[model samples]
Target: MYLVGLTGGIASGKSTVSSMLRELGCPIVDADVVARKVVEPRTLAHSRIVFHFGHEILLENGEIDRQKLGRIVFADAEKRKLLNSITHPEIHKEMLKQIIYYFLRGFRYIVLDVPLLFETRKLTHFLNHTVVVYCDPATQLSRLMLRDALTQEEAEQRLAAQMPLNEKRGLASHVIENSASREDTHRQVLRLHTKLEDSMDFLLVRVLAVAATAGLGGVLLYAAKMIFS
Candidate 1:
């Protein structure tokens, strides 16, 4: 199975790429989704967060107030690191579980969609390939402002929280340029999908052939033993 790590800057369209891959039948294990799950009301991570950050970060429904937490961490680098220290390990564990499950189910390709793939420096052993969805900084800023209804300064702060996109591109195995129109992006996605499918097919054939040869050799050995006996 090929494990692809997909990452992008804020509003750079990582989710869009993930959606496209999903449409093409790629199984995705989203780290953002897993992060949320790990911090549920009674989870150990949640308890740790409350102890560190106080109970005011909780909502009326007893769930963590993500907005309040985001405000605290995004405004302070130290707080952000503390938050990551509490949640990252749990998120990684859950992500690995999901990946193993999909691999066991015979998935040809699985995407680990993580926004901080480069920032965490944890991609080395986890991914067979890394794909970065990229767009111009201005485009990302504008889209983020409009999408999240944030002021320019607020948007910039959020953007600053992540590593620069250009730096990430340098480390990526594949770059999906998202600065172009939707049609262009779609074409790139389709092209990538074709290449990945071809590679997976080749790998599957090789594995099956090896298994068949091994089985045949075992059977032949058994037959020879019976004849000699």
Candidate 2:
């Protein structure tokens, strides 16, 4: 299977690209979605996070107060590392499971939509190609402030939490500049999808799918524990 990793900075429209791909029927394995799942109220990751950050990061009804936790981690380097240590492993494991499932289902390609693909240095290991959705810093900053209802300083802090967009552009095998209109962005995605379809390798994909099957039983037990505790 061809594994394509997609990422971009905070308000940079990476998610918009993922949605466009979904609209085109691409199988998308999203780390952000799974990351939220692994931290659901009773999960091990959630428990660890609460323990690390304290009860102050929880709501009155016991669910995590994500905004509160974000405030804590984004500003502190050690806390951010600690948070990544707790969450990234489970996210990667789930990501691999989803990829294997899509491969076995005979898909030639799948999108691994991970916001932190570059931050976590995961591109080299997990992807056949990497796509970075980019916009200029001014666009990013303004969009973030408007969308998240943050001030300029607050938006800058969130932006600082990740690598610069321009630097990530350099790391990418493909860059989708989202600074233009949505129509332009859609055209870029369609062009990229066509290129990926042209590059599929059947024999290699089947071999990898077979190899991945061996780990399924192991992660099921691990997943059970994660869900139960």
Candidate 3:
């Protein structure tokens, strides 16, 4: 199956568009979700983080206090890099597993919902199409401020931390304009879903699936012959 990388700036309504895609029956491998899972209480990433960041970043119940760790890492570039070095590998592994799961399920395509799809450029080469959900700057700013209850400056700082949406739009193979009403956004998502479903790129994945099945059957048949002989 082809992979679509879906991304947008902070508060750009990318998640809203992603949810719509899910409703359309697209399997999504969300990096944010996997990031959280990899750092859960007993995970290897969690142990490494605590070892490095110390117990002060943990809640009384022993789980990582994400907000506390976030504050620490956001202020220190080296610390932020260190944290990424620890978690990114695990996150990538888990996301790959999910992708393989969808591939084996015979999906036509799947979306990788990553907030840093453009910024990182790590997965762009592998994606058949990259989509950026976009909104006008004013709309994006207002949405972030209102949604997060952030002051204008705070919201602006958060937005400034990432690559601009305009840049991401330019880099994307497709852009979904999300500044309008939900109905408009829904229309865009529907069109995108149809486009992906109709693409001939899935033929490559289908071939691989057939090869994998044949390989498995050969192994099983050999094992059965040896057992009965």
On TM-score, the candidate that comes out on top is: 2
**Span of ten consecutive residues with least summed lDDT in model 3:** 220-229
- Candidate 1 runs further than 4 Å off: 200-229
The deviation in Å at residue 34 for candidate 3 is: 0.6
Output the better candidate (1/2) by lDDT.
2
lDDT of the candidates, in the order given: 0.85, 0.86, 0.87
Sort the candidates on lDDT, descending order.
Answer: 3, 2, 1
Scored by lDDT, model 2 comes in at: 0.86
Q: Judging by TM-score, tell me the better candidate of 1 and 2.
A: 2
Q: On a 0 to 1 TM-score scale, where does candidate 1 land against the true structure?
A: 0.86
Across residues 1-229, which tens digit of lDDT does each residue of candidate 3 receive?
8899999998999999999999989999999899999999999999999999999999998889987787677667789889988988888888887887997798999999999888777788778999999999999999988997878987777787788999999999999999999999999999989899999998876775576687765764454344222
lDDT of 1 by residue, 1-229 (tens): 7678899998999899899999989999999999999999889999999999999999998899987899899999999999999998888778777865886687778888999989987754546688999999999999999998889999999999999999999999899999988889989999988877766443753474466587765764454344222
Using Cα atoms with residue i matched to residue i, what is each candidate's TM-score against the true structure? 0.86, 0.89, 0.88
* Candidate 2 ranges with C-alpha deviation above 4 Å: 208-229
